[model samples]
Target: MPKEKSLVKNVMYKSLLSLFNIVVPIIIGSYATKIIGKDGMGEVFYADTIYQYFLIFGAFGIYNYGLREISRIRDNKEKLKQLFSSLFILGVASNIIVLLAYAGFIFFNYKGTSSFSIFAIYLFSIFSNLFYVEWANEALEKYDFITIKTIIVKLIYIVALLTLVKTPEDYLIYAGLISVALFLNNIISFVFIVKDIGFTLKCLTFRRHVKYLIMALIMANGNVLYTQLDKLFLGSNLGKDTVAFYTTPQNVVYMINAFIMSVVYVTIPRLSNILAANDEKAYLKLLNKVAKSLSLFLFPAAMGLTVLAREIILLYAKPEFLPAVPVLQIFTIYMITLAFESILSNQVMYVKKREKVLICFIICCGLFNLIAKIGLTKAGLLTPVTAVMTTVMANIILISLEFFYSTRVLKVDIPIFKLDKFKYLFISLLFIPITYGVKMIFASTVMITLVTMILCGSVYFGILLVTKDEVVIAILNKFLKRA
Candidate 1:
C-alpha cells in the first residue's frame, strides 16, 4: 500500500479546489447578474432553493455517512466494495422515489409557469445524482483528482455560460448549464471511482445502515431549515427580487466560509481514522491545530467582510443589490459561527460517533430558525435584513449548544478560548480602522476593495510573524523550501 499524503498537502489541494469553486461562481454570477438582471437571477436561484430541498431528501444523508464509513474501511477492499455497493444502491432507490414526488409537485403547483420550465431542466440533477458518488473519492482522500476534475468541468461550464446565456430570456438555459455541470461532475466521479472500489451487490445489507441513514436524513433536513429555507420564506413573503437581495450576499459569505472550512473538511477522514483507532491524544492535538488555524484566518475574514461589505456588493452585484450590503455585514457573524460549528459538529461530534446528540442540537436550532422567520413574516417584518439577522442568531445558538455539549457533556477538551486565538482576533480587529482609512482615501470601489484586502492581509500575517506564531512559521518554511 502507498503512504498517505501529509495533512498540509491534502489541505493545499482542498484549498485549491475551494478557491476554484469560489472563483468560477464569482465569474458566472458577476456576468449572469448583469445579463439576466435581479429578477432573472432571483428566479433562477429561487428554483434552485426549492430544488435543494428535494435534493437533500433524495440524498438521504448518504454523503456524510458514506464518507465516514468508507474512510474506516478504505484499506479493506472487500469491505469497501460491499459498503459502496449497498450505499450506491440505497441512494439510487431513494432518489427515484424523491424524483417522482418532485415531478408531481412541479406538475401540480409550478406547471404553466417559467419556473415550471426551470424545474424541468433541474430534473437532470436528480437523475445525475444516481451516479453521484463523489463521497467515495473524498473518503479515499483523492483531492488531487477531485480538484482537477472540477476545474476542467467548471471551465467547460464557464464557456457554456458565456456562449449560450446571452439574454435574460436565456435564464432557463443558464439553469440547464448548471445542471449539466453537476451532471458532468457526478458522471466523471462515477467513472473514476471504480478503480478504487468496484461495485458489488453480493454482500449488501440495508437493514444495518437504515438507522444511521435516517438520523443523517433528519440532521441534514434540520440543517436545510436555516440554510435554504430562508430563501423559500423570503421568496414567498417578499418576492423574487427580495430573494435576490438576500441570496446574493449570502452566497458571497458562503463562498468565504467554504474556503475557511476547507481546512476542517479535509481532516474529517483523518480525524475519523484516528478516533476509530482510539487515539485520543493525537485526535485532540490535531483538533487544536485545526482550531488555531481556523482562528488565524476566520477572525480576519469576518472582519474584512464586515468592513468591506459594501465594496464587495458593488464589485459582484449591481446597485439594486446594495440592499444586500447590510445583509452581508450581518452574515460576518454567521460565517464565524459556521466555521466553529464545523469543527465541533463535523470534527468532534460526528467523528466521535455522537450523532444523536448532534442531531438534537441541529433540530432544536433549526426549529427556532423556522419559527422565528415565520413569525417575522406573519408580523410583516421579514425583509432581507431581518431574515439574515434571524439566521445569524440561529447559528449562534446552534454553535453555542454544540460547544457546550462537546466540552461539558462529552468531556471533550476543546481549547476554544486559548489566548493565542484571542491574539489573532485582536489583530484582526485592527482591520476595521485600517480599512476605514483606505476607504476614505479611495473613491473607486475596485481600488478600495483591492487595497483593503492587500493591506489587511499583509498586516495580519506580519503581526503573526512578529509574534513567532508556530503555524505561520511552519507554513512559511514550507513555501520557502519550495521556492
Candidate 2:
C-alpha cells in the first residue's frame, strides 16, 4: 500500500507521526512534572535511562540495520520474510539475555533503592522493543500504517495517563502506563506483519547475520555511550532531581530535533537505493537539497530555543527547574549540530556503506563525552550544565569528522558549506531579536512562547520570500503549483 503512495503522501504521514511523538511527550512531561515535581520526574527518567541501556542490547541496531537491509530486498517477498524472521529471532534471543542481566544488575546494585521498582517497571519496555515491527514497515515506506498505529496507541496512552495518573505517589502508575502502551503498540504492529509479510523461520539462519549484526551492535554501543551516558552519569552522581532538571531542557531540544529529522529520515531508503545503484548524481542532488532544508529549519529552531530557554522552561517545567535555563541555552546549539550529524550519519554515511566511519566518529565522540562529563562533574560542576556543554562539544567533533570524511576522503561531491547556508543562517539569526522584542511585551510564559514562535516564524519566512532564497522559492513553487 505504501509502495503505491507518492513520496509527499508518505512524508505527510511521517510528519504527522513525528509531530505526535513530540506533542505527546510535551503533554505528558508537562502534566507529569506538575504531579510528580522535579525529583519524581527525574527518578522516572533516570530509570528510563537505565532501561534504555538494556534497550540498546535488545534493539541491536535493528532500527538502522534492519531498515536498510529490508529496504534493499523489499521487492522480493521470500527474502523479506526470511530476513525479518532472522532479525526478529535474533532480537528475541538478545533481549532475553539482556533482560536477565538487567534484572541481576538492579537486584545487586539497586536492591531496596527508591527508584528500583520504577526501574523494574521500565525494564518491560525491552520486551516491547524486541517485538517491534517498525523497521520492516519503515523499509517498505509504509509510513501511513506506522503513523496511524502510533497515533492510536499514543492517544490511548495519553487518555490513560490523564485518567489514571493523579499525584506524585502515582509515579509507578505512570511508568506502568508507558510500559503497557509500549507492549500493546508492538503487539498490534505485529498483527499487520502476519497479514502483510507473513511469519516464518523455514529458511532463515541467524548465524548468517552474525557479523553485520555485531557491527550494528558496536555502532549502537558508541551511539548510546554518548547519548544516554550523560543521564547515567548525572543520575548516578547528582541524584534524580538534578537529572530531572537536565532532562527537561534536553527533552525540548530533542523534540525540535525530532521534527527537523522528520524530513531527513524519509530520504534514507531512497538514498540507500541511489547509493546501491551508484547514482552519484542523484545522491549529490539529494544531499544538497537535504543540507539546505535542514539548515533552513534547524537554525531558527536552535535560535528560538536558545533565546526563549527561560520561557520554555517556565512553560514546560515548574519554577524549581529555573536552573535548567542555562542548560537549555547551551544545549540549544546541539539542535544545529545534531541536525547535520543525523542526516550525514543516517541518510548519507550509512546509505553509502560508511559504517566504519560512523563507528569511528561515534566512538571518538563517546570517549570525549565520557571524559569531559566525568571530569567536569568531579570538579564540582553540576550535572545538568556540565553534561549539556560536553555533549554539545562531542557532537561538534562528530559532525566535523563526518563532514571531513564524507567530502575529502570519500569524495562524495556534496557541498559541506554553501553561500545560501550563510544567507539562511543570517536570516534565521534575525529571529532572535525579533522574537525577543515580541517576548518582552508578554509576561505570560505561554503567550510569549506562542506569539514569538508565530510572529518570528512568519518574519523568518517573509524574509526568505523577499530574498527569493532558492530553497524557499523551490519549496513554495512546488507546493503552489501542486495546489
- Pairs in steric clash, model 1: none
Q: Write the per-residue lDDT of candidate 2 for residues 253-328, one digit (tens) a residue.
A: 8887887777788877767766767788988898788788778887888888888888888878789999999989
Q: Which ten residues in a row have the lowest lDDT in candidate 2?
A: 1-10
TM-score to true structure, per model? 0.98, 0.95
Question: How does model 1 fare in lDDT?
Answer: 0.88
Tens digit per residue, CA lDDT, model 1, 55-164: 98899899889988888888888998999999999999999998998899899999987679988887888988898998888888888999999999999999989999
lDDT of every predicted structure (CA atoms): 0.88, 0.81
Best by TM-score: 1
Per-prediction CA RMSD (Å): 1.2, 1.8
Off by over 4 Å in 1: 1-3
Q: Pick the candidate with the highest lDDT.
A: 1
What C-alpha lDDT, on a 0 to 100 scale, does residue 305 get in candidate 2? Answer: 87
lDDT of 2: 0.81
